[model samples]
Target: MVKCRALKRLKDAPPSTPSKKQAILQHYMCVSPTAKQSLKRQSPSLSEKVLENMKGFIHETKQKRNSDARNAMHVISASVSGEKISKGEKSKAARKLGLQPRRLSGGQRIRTSVLRSEKSCYEFTKRKTRSDITSDETKKQAYDFWISPTVSHTSSNKTDVKRSRIGPNEYVSHQIHLLEKTQTEVFLDFKAKYPDFKISQRLFESYKPFFVMPVKQKHRNTCCCRQHIEVRILFKKCMEFRKNLHASNLDLTQENLPVFEHLNDICAETVCDKTALHAQCLNRSCKECGVEKLSFNDNELDTSRNARDIKWDKFEYTEINVKGRKTRTKLMLVSKKTKPGEMFNHFKSLLETFPAHQNRANWQSEQY
Candidate 1:
């Protein structure tokens, strides 16, 4: 009875405030169906107002939710149709629709033309093997070229330094052959000769025989003529001095001017007709290819020191008494103040002193 009086007082108030209307709606919602009917009977106008406000609020909320869904759908459709939609906008739409950002759309596949162009631009060299070179004739040709006498020469000391067994009770002793030119130079020469031949540098190197090897410094003869050595050194120094003078804009006398400047032009024109070693040009005998002289400057040859005074050493086999037995052993023979010319004269004097029969066998047996 007390609640009924309070409700009556609220309804009889002068004007219906929002707070009063909200309280009345809350009360209607909390009451049972039978209680609601009783309340409606007591205040029919207040029940009608509460029902109308609830219906309008529900309608507006449903329209807003539907409009958000439509906008999200439009954004997704635009992205799929190739329209310019940024990832941020797409993610925003996805969030409005309550979906993961990445899951909003499927990724587009790359174009076939683009993939082809990428494949064409990217290059990789395939490794080559002996099997790739299937021509036996080509291999034979390369082998022949490498083993030619002009390209390489057999060592004079033919005693088998290395021996390898190929079969039972059979052995092969290969003679060492020294290469005149480097392997790379030989390959370049071969390529020049056979332009059609296709070969890699590695493959060309593999074709070299096991016995053939590069010449070492120790194998080279160091006993060069002193006169020739001095001439070469003088010429090199003159060339350098001439270059420095020319760079500094200094004038050179007629005698100091280069004499063989025209040699390069002459050789370029007649090189094809010349021999392999250019013997005619070197001999200065051929009318078409001879050179009279080659002088860099009018520098006099320095001849104050005796050529015989130059001390040098050479590797030679010397007969030595080992355990009272004469054994030939390799030794570095050092000659003091004795030039090659004097040594040759001494050898001739020894031959003249000994008889012809004794000279042939015993002369070489001497330690000196």
Candidate 2:
């Protein structure tokens, strides 16, 4: 009724009559106690001209409030879409906008009024079941691919073997195989091979055989040959020398330091055929294969210790008397200054002595 009265007064007022405008304003103040109170609360210093344009001012204020609300809604939508805001932030925004938050089936609570607005509606998609996503044949194919001998080689270590129970009093032993690539790498390779088949990383990992293990440092054979060991030691020494040079503010290039590649080149040039194993080449006394030494300047190389004379302490199982009882214990065995050739010959002699018996015993043990 107040709005109607105000509009009726506005229409009846003359286009350029001060008396007419004054009459309309007086009518509004007399009829609407709220408008009179609002006008009174305004600054007393407000001029008559400002009062004349009060309607326009109120309209502008309403428009600004609406514009602010719209902008806030847009900001909230952008944040929600980009996943920049947390649930708490969404709740706080909703509360500020006088909107109630609603909880979804997934336990996520959000402002339905903001997220599910006409401009941008939040959509929820039903997750596909395993059977729906992948057919049985596809799963079987994936399993077969994962368990293939070529993809993952069987571990030679007996400790790595695993046994699984199939039924009551029934069990099956599997020779554990180590995967050549990481789980992610394997999945990528599988995807490359079967582009049509869609599988997530988690799903691919689940499909991996329990017997198939990832390659780790512990899984590697730490034992290296004498030549390789010497090379490793040489590399360490070179690294230390380089570090020392760096500490002393001296420029040390590759030419100043000995590298494994140089030693490898020497071996390639003087040793047996490249196809032959390093151990085999070193063992054979062929005219073509012989030991080659790398010569370095006295200043460049550390001659404090001789590499050839370095001996390794080995642990051997020895019978010891403990409280008059014979018990086998590992004792540190110090090696004599025996050449590789002499050691090889000594072992060859021992093997020859027990060759027939050893072969028979090994055959019997394998059968069991």
Candidate 3:
């Protein structure tokens, strides 16, 4: 009776200052019948507790996964192998669990490509097994291999010089030596021997000091016949005379010129040949009217005799002493002061200027 009287007093109070009992009554009236039944069956705090429990369960699963010895694949394999599960079973499990399997995407493919390229580069630059490292023989072998025309080639397809045990600087020096040697040695032979070197005629050209040659086979063994022997003797004599002249410290004079007559013959024979005369040859001659007229000659030779009309150019002439009389004689400026190597190159240049041919009459109209 007392509690009922208190409720009546609370409801009878002014609306502006409504009591807590009046608010509770209004909330109960506004709610549906189902919400009323749920409120009675379950406590409001119980739902928050259930949510907290679920969160803790998820956290425990994550920790278990992190603590596993191997990967998910291992776990999946063990699970499937024990139950004889197939792909269909796995997919059904995934669907039932509302879980999506991890998969690689386009971004993954790009990343994998980058990773593979980096791995290859690392493998290429990594150290390898070498039994003969830091040995004198190894270094020497490396040097020889580096300088050899045969071994120098593409960086991709490197020769087996890693075992040679030489330093990078030493290898570079070996390369320099090889380049220098190419100028002297026959190019075709050099290329044949060092096919990997990738040394081209155009590369030799970049270095002005070296002479470039065509890539073709040449006779390895030349004849040492009487004519060859005589020519060789003449060349030796000329070289000897030039050395003697240089050693003499003598001034320019006609008396010293006659000894070089044989040398002049050699020079003329070299210059008027098909090679020298045809290369950059104007093929012009001085006519009676004092005008230079174009002339052409067949690249022919009379090898039957020691000397013949080369007809390409006049023999070099300079004032010389013969029996105490000054007269025009062949000049020998080529051998006067040049080194042996330089002399050989100069002569060779003359020889290769024109093409070679057999004996013929008026063959200028046709190509050799």
Task: Compare the candidates by lDDT and give the number of the best one.
Answer: 2
For TM-score, the strongest prediction is 2
* Candidate 3 lDDT score relative to the true structure: 0.36
The alpha-carbon root-mean-square deviation between model 2 and the true structure, to one decimal in Å, is 24.3
| Reference-based TM-score, model 2 | 0.30
Off by over 4 Å in 2: 1-132, 148-151, 157-252, 259-280, 284-291, 296-368
Among residues 3 or more apart in sequence or in different chains, the pairs in candidate 3 whose N, CA or C atoms overlap within 3 Å are: 149-194, 150-194, 152-197, 254-321, 274-354, 275-353, 275-354
Q: Against the true structure, what is each candidate's TM-score? A: 0.26, 0.30, 0.18
Of the candidates numbered 1 and 2, which has the greater TM-score value?
2
Q: Rank the candidates by TM-score, best first.
A: 2, 1, 3
Clashes (backbone N, CA, C under 3 Å), per candidate, total 0, 0, 7
- Ten-residue region with minimum lDDT total, candidate 3: 169-178
* Cα lDDT of model 2 by residue, 177-263, tens digit: 778877788888888999988778888776665567776544454333343343434444444444555565555444654343332
How far off is residue 33 in model 1, in Å? 99
- Cα-based lDDT at residue 144, candidate 1: 71
lDDT (C-alpha, whole model) for all candidates:
0.48, 0.49, 0.36
Q: For candidate 3, lDDT tens digit of each residue in 1-368?
A: 99999988866763654576577767875687876787678755986676555445434453464546234433432332222444456555444333332211222333334333423322222233234333433333333443344523212112211212124321110101113234435446545665755545543233221111222111111232333343444356434544554556466344443234443344333333434444223222212211111111111112333323221111244777777565767643322433333333333333232212211111431221
